[model samples]
Target chain A: MQPQRIAVVGAGAVGSYFGMRLAEAGHDVRFLMRRDYDAVKSGGLHLSSHLGDLSLEAATVERTPEALAAHGPVDWVLVGLKATAIPDIPKLVGPLLSEGTRVLAIMNGLSVDEEIAAELPAGTSLFGGLGFIGVIRGEPGQILHQEFGAINLGHHGDDPHELQRGVDLFAGSKVEIRPEASLLKARWEKLCWNIPFNGLCVIAGGVPVDQVIEDPPLYDAAHELIKEIVAAGNADLEAHGQSARIDGPRIAHLFLTQTLGMGAYRPSTVIDYNNGRPLELDAIFRQPVQRASQLGIGVPMMSMVASLVGKLGERVE
Target chain B: MQPQRIAVVGAGAVGSYFGMRLAEAGHDVRFLMRRDYDAVKSGGLHLSSHLGDLSLEAATVERTPEALAAHGPVDWVLVGLKATAIPDIPKLVGPLLSEGTRVLAIMNGLSVDEEIAAELPAGTSLFGGLGFIGVIRGEPGQILHQEFGAINLGHHGDDPHELQRGVDLFAGSKVEIRPEASLLKARWEKLCWNIPFNGLCVIAGGVPVDQVIEDPPLYDAAHELIKEIVAAGNADLEAHGQSARIDGPRIAHLFLTQTLGMGAYRPSTVIDYNNGRPLELDAIFRQPVQRASQLGIGVPMMSMVASLVGKLGERVE
Candidate 1:
């Protein structure tokens, strides 16, 4: 495959990690950054990973999306901002999109691709990239990639070729990408982990994943949340005419069992909460909870987490 | 009321305040102290209240129940310890209990009187004293009374006169005591406030009652919790052959409205959590959540709070 040109928008930890990997694979990658723009422009971007360390001393840093677009439309624009910043997708991502430009949204939360797609030009190829890893943004221009560098790639757009393109971008990198036939199912699978871990971590006094896994009630609450979310996800899948149904109890057991080994992994939501930054409430909680409600699914754990996470988020403002 | 003989068990802040008052009013009130025994014995006890300041320089500090019994069985025994300490009820309150002695349980949570009664001798006159005040134990031997020192007193025994006897004990004191015909309803009424505020405060990152009131989802969650608890209470009351039933929406509105003026009021549970002390889980959340489950009521929010609070409680251990 020929080398690709990629523009990374909202290049936070996850975005920066993937874009850096893609760029290291000989793809021409440019980052549209703000907070870390100066640091990245001068010191360049660095990813300290368990698997390996990677750094770009002469990384390209574009101050604005307009500046990023001026370099010409990239093959793919990676929308890696927090779900809370999804609303700014149009202004930040719109300028970087050409008619053929595909998007690989590397953000957590449900219906984010749809949200980003709705705001951008119609029929644009939007691929949902759910990153399953422990990564955090450190002192400017640095990514602390703790473990599990894997991506669940699913296409939300009509272009079937977009899925292959999404997979190809990470083909030569150390990062493993698993392409899914159903984006909805992949997102829901991610929710099984995110809704419980992210929500419980913040709601249960901003503790880490191990705390949620260790505390029986919280651990039980986590499973209850997973059960509720899985059921809702299955119901929504059915409603959307997809034959993708999640097995609730099994998924709960799997995620919780996996979490037991996660040690003290702090989900990004807890990090955001402890830092008093805005949470991805709508994309992660409110949207899913609302969808569950619309489907007449009773999501008490989901609802509780949503409101509590919502309240926790408001503590910053 | 000729200066009654009173023994205060679990004399924390609330116990110290009321005991100091009774002692000031010319009654013989001895406190069975543990943590604050030496300080109280040396420096006496103090009550810094909004209504007025009160102190007892010569406060009686009994090291043990047997030591307390040496002064003879008091007319009334005030149990003001945290509900978590209720298992020691028999050992702590037994020495001070005579056939004629009336017991006043000044603790929070569901069926505390019943639990205490079960642990004590049968046919004993028991009273439930639900205190509505913002009081916290500060420095040893000190009581920080923020506002509203009122106790809803209700007889929980076969003796009809026990309520009046309980009322007369606090009659001359500055602390107001309102007698209720039904102890169950009164306790339920108190739960209307405690379940939501206490549970939500700790669960939502050790925030105050105001945050629970101010945040929309938390505010809504608080109401949802109140409704679940109130329904469970009503059902339990009916099952117990009581005619009392709580009007859910009205009570919810009243408590939430009341909380708006309670700026930054940290509930005792939140305080216990922040201090890493064992929470009054069995008395406050588990017992009630269990009772609700037994009644076949769906208490998602209540269950979530119970498990989270339970987990949060275990964090200290």
Candidate 2:
């Protein structure tokens, strides 16, 4: 396949990492960023990982969506923007998308699909994405990917073939893209595992997961709470007839292990909190809570967690 | 009746206020304190309020429990020790309780009575106390009453007649003993009001009461949580078959008003949290939560607050 031109939106850790790798692999990649542009222009987007530090000297870094139009059209637009930044999506991405352009959203919440679907040009191909890389910003125009995995992508609708061109583009590089059997199921499965653990760690100021898991009462409460998220997500997926599937105990075990394994790394919510940056609390916590409420699932712990993190975000403002 | 000789334990705010008042009224008084004696012996004790400042040159201060014996026995002992120093209660009052030395506890929380009761000699009069004065250590051997109101003291258990001496001794002073049908109810009432507001304000690094109360959802939750406390307290009283006469709605109203009126006065918990001092978390919050659980009352919000505060305490430590 000819190397497709890609515009990576919100060039923070994850977006920058994938963009850098694609550019290094000789694909035409452009990073859409604001403050990071000067640094990227100077250093050409250096990425350090446990694997190795890689630099993308050929990648073009642009500041605005209008500037991306100046570079002409792109085949794919990958959005890794923070959910709080979603309201600005239509404004930011409008100039970059054509009718044939595929939009892939890799974020940490259940609302990413709806948010992107609302902002993108009508009839544009939509590929749902979830990135499992443990990435952090090392400096301006520099990021650290401590762990690497396939950037999972799925077609938003029942047509599995909808995302083959974009998937092939990523497969041509070092990144992997698995066609999800059911995108809704995949999204909810991610939510079932991600939201509770993230919320818990962030609100408790990132107490080591091992320590929290040791406490039987908190542990049990957490498991039940995660199950609530799972149930809610499953219900939502089932409503769409998207074949909901989540191994509850396995996900719980994974949460415990991941927490213990990465005890030192601050979660994304904690990072946002520490940086005085706007958090994706509404998208990540409140949106799911609203969904659970709509489905009439009693998610007491989820609601409590949402309220606390929401109040915390409000206090920061 | 002869002027009752009073022993003031922990010559801090509450102790010095009442102790100095009684001493000025021509009642014999001795203060049992650690560093208070040296300061008092050198310059006497300075008592200041909006009313006036008095240098009590005649008031004696003892540095230790043993020194209290050297100063001679007294008829009444007012224990004003910090709840953190509760373990020293027995030793502080040991020298003063020769025969009829009645004990009055003017501290935060409900465990003070049980803590001191276990240590007091059998047949000695025991009374519960609540001070409405907002006082603190102004300087060495100096106490300042920022806000002044009448005190409440009465017997906790049987023998309502046991508090007459307290009433008589506090005569002519601002201290007024409310003849409560049950002192335990009064203590619990104070605890119910203190836990949420105090902990929230303190843990937010001394954000004044107004900040927490001004927060819409938090303010409402705080008000409701206090009602839960009142309900829990009543349950406790009913379990003992004591009079559960505290008006929950009225108390909640008083607390909301108190928070608004406090303006910039940071609660002691906030001060302690800021200074890395040992917090009264377990005493004020955890104890009540435990009590609630024993009573089979659901206090999810209170328990969450307690857990968060407990975690904050651990972080600062």
Candidate 3:
């Protein structure tokens, strides 16, 4: 397989890990990060795991669009910021989007492809990628790879084969790309787990995973939330004349079991709250519940949880 | 009338305010304090207000039971600890509870009187009192007196004439006592306002009254919480063969309006949180909710708010 050129935008945890892994595999990769741009430029890139620590001395790191244009057009742009940060991307790097340049939003929540595609150039291919990683910024130049480091890739509209080419490019990287024929199923399944766990963990003040692992209220809430997301997703799929693929309830239970097995991994939202960063409450929770409302699906549990968390976020002074 | 001999326990804020006032009124008052005895002895007791700043140049303040008893046996003991601190009083100064002594527990929430009564000896009378004073230790010896300083006194389960005598003693001092014949109503009415505003302010990062005065959901939530407390209090009243006095819904509105008018006053829970002291969650919130369950009253809104706030308290590291 030919080595593909990749750009890892907002290279914090998930981006740094995946980018370094792909670069280590001898693919052409560059990290576009805000904080570690200086350190990463000096040190190339560093990725550390409990398994082993690998430093990519030859990988490129840059901060601005001018720097990226100097390296020329990339084949894949792994957009890794929170969904709320999606609107700011075009303003950040209008020069980075060349013809055939695929922007894969490797973030949480649902319908991110539509969000990204609406802003990109007309001929630009939009890809939706769901990352299943528990990576944290261990230090300025290192990402602590935690649990469930995998990715699911699918196209926005009717095409699945085109999305696979982007998925296959990430095949030999540290992250797994599980290419699904149904993008709707893939997106819904990720949202099913992300909304409850992230929103609850953040709102409940980063209570340990074991605290909610066996707890019936939390588990039940997660299951109920997923059901609501599934109902809403199905409504969207039906409106778009497409078939829903994921079994939301079953996926919820499986995720709960996985949570029990995962052994004390803090959810992304929890980490964000602990670090005093802006939470993705709007994207993962509010937007999903809003979409559910649009579909006339009652989501009392998620809505309540979202409301509490959203309000709590406002008070994070 | 001759000034009644008085003993004030837990000389912080309310206790110190009442103690100094009683001492100034020519009553032989002894303050039984744990921490600030040495400071008060060195600097003397200072109470600052717009009305006037008063000082007790030669006041009786003691840390130990033996030192407190040196001032002679008292007719009345005004206990003014935060509700959670009530359990510790029995062990701290058991010598203060003498025969035929009336113990006015000027603390917040329900069960404080019961907790004290359980520890009291036979022939000891107990009273319930609530103070709407915003007093804090300004320094080692000085107490800052903010606005709306008033006291409400009544008997929990005692003779009205005896309760009036207790009220008369406080009235002789600068502290104005709003004598409620039914103490149960006074206690419940305070709880109604407290459970909502205090818990909400503390949990929502100590939101001062001005923030939520105009907001509908917050104001509504406060109203709902107070109503539930009223329901629980009414049930408690019925179980104990007493008549409920205060109107919950009406008082909730009054409390909200008063808080809004005050503008700068933060609830006691917020002060505790800011001072890095343990919050009164178990006493102020959980205990009442447990009692509500025992009384077979449905307090759904208050329960959720309590759980949410309790969770917030649990996160305070």
RMSD to the hidden true structure, all candidates: 5.8, 5.4, 4.5
State each model's CA lDDT, in order: 0.86, 0.74, 0.75
DockQ-based ranking: 1, 3, 2
Chain B TM-score by candidate, in order shown: 0.95, 0.93, 0.93
DockQ preference between candidates 1 and 2, better one: 1
Ranked by lDDT, the better of candidates 2 and 3 is 3
Q: State fnat for each of the candidate structures.
A: 0.47, 0.05, 0.19
Candidate 3 structure quality by residue, lDDT tens digits, A118-144:
778776777777888778886678778
Candidate with top lDDT is 1
Model 1: colliding residue pairs: none
The estimated TM-scores of all candidates read 0.74, 0.75, 0.81
Give the chain B TM-score achieved by candidate 2. 0.93
Residues B254-292, model 3: lDDT tens digits: 887787787767788878866767778877888888888
Cα error, residue A51 of model 2, in Å, equals: 5.7
Q: Return the lDDT, model 2, position A120.
A: 74
